[model samples]
Target: MSEEKNEITLKNYQVKIQDGLLQHLAEFIKPLWQPKKIAVITDDNVGPLYVDKVEAQLIEMGHRVVILTVPAGETSKSWEQVQVLIDSLAQNNFVRSDGIVALGGGVVGDLAGFVASIYMRGISLIQIPTSLLAQVDSSVGGKTAIDLNAGKNMVGSFYQPNLVLIDPSTIQTLPKRMLVEGYGEIVKCAALVGGSFWEIVQKVHQPADIILQAESLIHASIAFKASVVMRDEKENGLRKLLNFGHTLGHALELIEDGQLMHGEAVAVGMAYITAAFEKKGMTAAGTTAEITARLAQVGLPLVANQLGSAAFYRAMLHDKKIKGDQIILVYIKKIGEPAFYPLKITELKKWFEPILNSQIEDN
Candidate 1:
């Protein structure tokens, strides 16, 4: 991809999403023919579900396909799994010019993408997002990583894909909880680009059409992300804005020991952070109620609990976003307006005390 006059002809890859996207993988991916071999990395869950269909089409198109399946879910996105994939690629004589297609949700995309990045120094990555969250969020940005014992995404890279294939119909296979889990990313965009768009999230009849009418909302979230990524592909800058709900979110997950999904904790974290955003007058009146209703509609959380407050704060302090004990929290003033909040490390222990008080009810 070359940047000519601030216009980068996104040659690296393409985002071709239409109805019935999965079966048409061969058709939509014509530009991806440069690779000598194609490795489709998926997980145990998504492979049996969609692989045969996609592979049949790829074979018909005369492409040599390599299939690599990792255990499904977050735990699979680790150094060990990545090592297995890398070893497989090596055994298969994979080359730098070869491209890897990531199939599944964010976990698959991240794990495979990191492999694509580190293997042979750098390799091309193609994204086929089977989940709504991956389609709209994770798959687009080059940000790819795995969790560390220290914190989430503590080990990763900014490896963009050569192409992003989105099949909205895939959502049909997504469990209700998975479908609902995606809304938190949507809501993160909602809170980041606060305005009447948040109202649409509150009032839209068809959730499917919300992003269409509100493309800017998605773009806003990405813009916020791009600002961070553009400056720090390594996550060294404005990218912290994307962690709006992740402070308490990561901790809640740690406490649950990954019993809940990433977005689940984020949902709870968003609800918890609302107290701080509200206290600061960043959140509009009544908006909290509206988000609560919306979250419930999609099956997200609207509060955090006291049981894991200590561990959650501990995780936050050790978080990758922390800088010398100063926790930088992303706070929303309204929909579409997000700002950074740098809190002292010493105050973090005291910070959650008032925020987690029973005064603020959880949904």
Candidate 2:
């Protein structure tokens, strides 16, 4: 079959998804932002595998390339790392015309994209997302951010990339856990986009198999995201639906302190929140059980009692989604659709206690 290509046109630019597109980096970027200089920011784990290949290709095409690598994992998304990256960019004599290429997972994509958004006020950003999570979600939206000690993505901006290149073949290099983490996001997308996509997801139980079967799923997920983002680029409206499991997910991640990957945390959030919503009569009957089973089949944690419900609730108060007295919560109406429900901060513990306490029953 021919390579899959998708173009998502926003008011400013487009997102392109194609298999093995990274090999043609030169040609792919030539039409977007033909830069004299490019800063390829990646993490240590990914740098050894793909960054050099990208650098060599860019050099062969006669463009100046600078490769910068930070320690891998979620910690790299801190404000301190962002400062270090900025200082490095300045020290390298990078100018406004130079572009940034985010070549890792969501962490690198968020950090590098945030850097590009602020450097010289703004510059071109080309996302060559390697990880499945980055490829399917973070890389497409242009919502760049760094974490503060207070919360995940405490600081962020809605900066769109000039172009996004999704190369599904790159996912083959990911670790099993990483792939499973990506599956968490994929499950989120499938649950939100229901229809043929959900049907396709129902058959697979392993993350490794997704690479072999990702062609249509990746395209569909990105297409769905693009449509939502195009309608609400700043996330002031419809885009919030995409946060289905993210509210409590972010809280669990913060409470766990790097033990939980983004996808894993979101998986728990999906299950617990679905249960909570069902209990409140907000979601359809059995929605919780359906989501919990899907998440459990993928080996995701379904309970958050590891940190205790009180602490989890405390951590949640730090989420940026909180608005004064009420926080915006995203809940699934069914497998393919989602709706937002804002809840008072004071009532969070009452709602979250049973789900967090489920861990005791599970044990």
Scored by CA lDDT, what does every candidate get?
0.72, 0.81
**All predictions: root-mean-square deviation over Cα?**
3.7, 2.7
Off by over 4 Å in 1: 1-11, 204-232, 280-284, 306-308, 359-363
In candidate 2, what are the lDDT values of residues 1-363, reduced to their tens digit? 112356656556666777778888777777666648888999999899888789998888777888889999878988788889889889988889888888999999999999899988887888888888898889877799888888888887889898888888888888878877887888898899889988877777665567777776678788888788878888788988888899888888988878898989999888878877777787898777777666777677776555455678788888767788999999988788788889999888777776555542121
Where is model 2 more than 4 Å wrong at Cα? Answer: 1-5, 358-363
Q: Write one digit per residue (lDDT tens) for candidate 1, span 219-320.
A: 333444444455555566666777878887877776678777777778877776767667657677654555556676655766655433566666666677
TM-scores for the candidates: 0.87, 0.93
